[model samples]
Target: MDWQKNLLIAAIIAVLFMLVIRWNDFQESLPAANAPVSSAQQTDFNASSDAATAGDIPSLPGTTQAVPVANSTSTNVIKVVTDSLVIEIDPQGGDIVHVALPRHYDALNTPDVPFVLLDNRDHHTYVAQSGLIGANGTDSAAGRPLFTSAQTEYRLADGENQLNVDLVFQQGQTTITKRFVFTRNEYLVNVDYLIDNRSDSVWSGNLYGQIKRDSQSFHKVSALEMNPFLGAAITTNDENYKKLTFKDLNESEFRTVKQGGWVAMVQHYFVSAWVPDANQENNYHLRRIGNQDIYLLGFTGPRVEVAAGSTGSLSTSFYAGPKDTERLAEISRYLDLTVDYGWLWWIAKPLFWLLKFIHSFVNNWGLAIIGLTLVVKAVFFHLSATSYRSMARMRKLAPKLADLKERYGDDRQKMSQEMMKLYKTEKVNPLGGCLPILVQMPVFLALYWTLMESVELRHSPFFLWITDLSVKDPYFVLPLIMGLTMWLQMKLNPTPPDPMQARIMQLMPVVFTFLFLWFPAGLVLYWVTNNTLGILQQWYITRQIEKADTTA
Candidate 1:
């Protein structure tokens, strides 16, 4: 049947849709075949040879002078706990070496274990680093300044909305206080450098913040699963958002000067970003550290000068948490783009908004998905009706089409001519059955990305035996039902005349079922709902047309 050929084309387009959007990303992620393998041993923060150097910090706007690294020793670690965050700071640089989300679990089976977003262990080296750098900076090519905190650990008190953990470093007559202000239920931390210059000369330095991470993925995904972006991203004056893969950093350095922007390291469901003062002109940089696999993405604010015997403060914000679009947008202009819905963001955004709105009332993502499918179906009801009416008219002529095929057996050109005549006389569009699938392909793809990128859907439950919608259906029940609905939908349409084409069409459901077995349950649920609805509509339309013909 002509509908089968059109269906095959629609299926090919649907499957390759997302792949086409992410083709560049996929290419960038591919490792170079001739790339040299490093044999260096991994080291902890205290002894890591890939530590901060003068070259690591961005030079003054037009100056190329190198700043010397200070000679310092490692100090005690300061731990701070809030309702939403657990943070570990290295006093040596007042850097956030480790961060965990108390509200998010590391795994579904491990309720007590919080998800670690940043770590500085021997095996892993992802951490948030910040310090003063310039002619009068304390951090240098050799080492960073060692600071002292009032206590080894600090916890947010109940009923308190804000908590302050301060680390103090003394250099000659200058006292620099690094204060991290944490809110009771927020992931954004206010990092302020209160410089109390007691010396006769002025205190001048640039406050730089950066996230350093090795080119190692913490989350393991199968070869068949969709690989989320695991790299660096930034907002620039020219573009609202841009991404730099680890390989991109290795190939060349990325440098830009913008009034106010954010740099971040993005992963599957979470992100860590540094947002500088909106009024300050900051220099953003992304590059690999020497020949090592570690990459750094950060910004250096314009010089901050404190007069002799006076006090001044430089402030920035750091966010380490899930990629909540609304909260991220509140933090920076384009920070929310980190959620990354691909090229169909215009469509995906509204779909996500609708899904979220539905979930707000239903309180179940699965139910919300079904409601969303219904809304989408209703939106395209008239167009679908037109296509179904055409298909119904064709179905009424199926017996006649079979007779023509039998009469013109072994006569290819004659059969084609007769089929066209039949289609024209009956006013049935041979390709009309594919119109619905073609029109809905974008929505289908948008929903796929929406489900894949929305953090709220992570670990969300539907009903019995369906938990964690962000992952696959553990028992493969949804995929099986999705396949069954697909098969039934196919049955409602006229079978193809050619045996080989019919066989291929018959195997499509099986192929799609296996492909969807590893997809997120929320997405699979949406597909199943859409397919089931399609079957009902096709069957109803086909029945009405056949009954009318019989009556006539």
Candidate 2:
């Protein structure tokens, strides 16, 4: 085999190795692994609401006005209402997303609510930790203090309606500006931080804040988790992501996952909270980038720290909206950060760029997927052609391989080596049949992740009987046709010569068909289309080879 083909096959094996490693990571991170739990973060916070200062934030009718603090320094006030959030940001340093918890939440339906009720005293905010981490590690105000700094200073805007808080850490030499955005819709309030360092030395810290929920029953789930392996693990923690809703896994036995970049999408029906990053020392979630598990998309990127006397900015866009993909995608890529394309981002990203481009032209994601698929097939045609020709040649030489094998049955390895020598001398590559398929796997998986995790395909349809492309293929039609196409292509070209291997290869179509039966319709569509295209190419190659053989 040529070096290029050899490298490609070797690379594919490496990729598969990575995939197997990723698959096993969950088990290793499971609590039974007995890894050490990471320690809690150490950072101090002094927060003051803008309600006592520049009260520009609009508030919902039911929202309570900001209760005054002894000495707060902030100049913004915001009110949150049902279906609306108010956010205020200072150009240089800080910003806030105002939240309003509806007064009549009890009147609404809730599957689970906590038994313990802890709302920090009316005027004071509390301390909470979230982001990619363990459940207990996520600990949102579990009766902990809302704010951490020992001493506090409060500055109210001249208008008396707005308040500004200047939180200074004696040891850290930093002051953070936190403001309360109020919502009349509910008791929930958004606290935003504009943290800065005035110290001569570099001040590095994360934004520490908290939300005090009265309910103890808060659990997490995500719109991005489409894999059964992941869903199985989370099921133990009480999840209802897709088809396998509320099916329990062995989460209690697992305890807290200790891997870093630990994120969990806690969903209780309509409401969901996110933990984007967790303390990795004790946290145990599989990695974010390499694994590209849907749950960890937003959990990606590095644990950032600011330079000496320099300000680093990071923002989280909280969605108080419904779980609808269309609604969620409308929030920004940041909000849909759970949509991961895996390692094929090189392919997936460009594909997304193309999909978005096609979407711009046609305004339909289904059509966009088709358009994107065609473009990809076209781009890969060069490599595909090489593979097609190799498969055709293999079929042509199959009789010769049988003759050689029968002539050298006593030494299988020697027979295979001589067969390969014959193949090389004849300018035929047996690997050519497999290399293209291997080459395409990364792109295929990237697209799978794209379609599986993307809100663009969520609930989007492509013609009849396939309403939600993000969900399982409803009628099993696409997968069956996919299998049929693959079978036809297999017949048109060639398979492994070993009887068992050939039989296994013959059954591959059926295996994949059954496997894809429950996959998203979009993925099935892509595979079916891919197989149909391959069938056409294989038939053409076969015809050309037959004519050449006859002429020769």
Give the candidate number with the greatest lDDT.
1
Against the true structure, candidate 1 has what lDDT? 0.84
RMSD of each: 3.9, 15.1
Candidate 1 vs. true structure, TM-score: 0.92
> Residues 47-114, candidate 1, lDDT per residue (tens digit)?
44334443455566677735455334255689999999999998888889889997999888888989
Candidate 2 per-residue lDDT over residues 1-552, each given as its tens digit = 234334644664575464333333121112211133343311111112222122211111234322222233234432222323222222112222222223213211331322111122222221122221112111122211123322232323333444333322223455544444333322223444444655676543333221212111222212322322222111112321211111222122122332222222332222223332333222222211111111111222233455557555433323332234344344332333333344565677666667778889987777777778788899888899889899888887888878776888678777877788888888997778777878787887878766755645654667777766767766778878888987888787765556655666677677677667766788778777777777787788778878988999
TM-score of each: 0.92, 0.52
Candidate 1: Cα lDDT at 98: 89
Which portions of model 2 miss their true places by more than 4 Å?
Answer: 1-208, 211-338
Residue range with the least summed lDDT across 10 consecutive positions in model 1? 26-35
lDDT scores of the candidates, listed in order: 0.84, 0.45
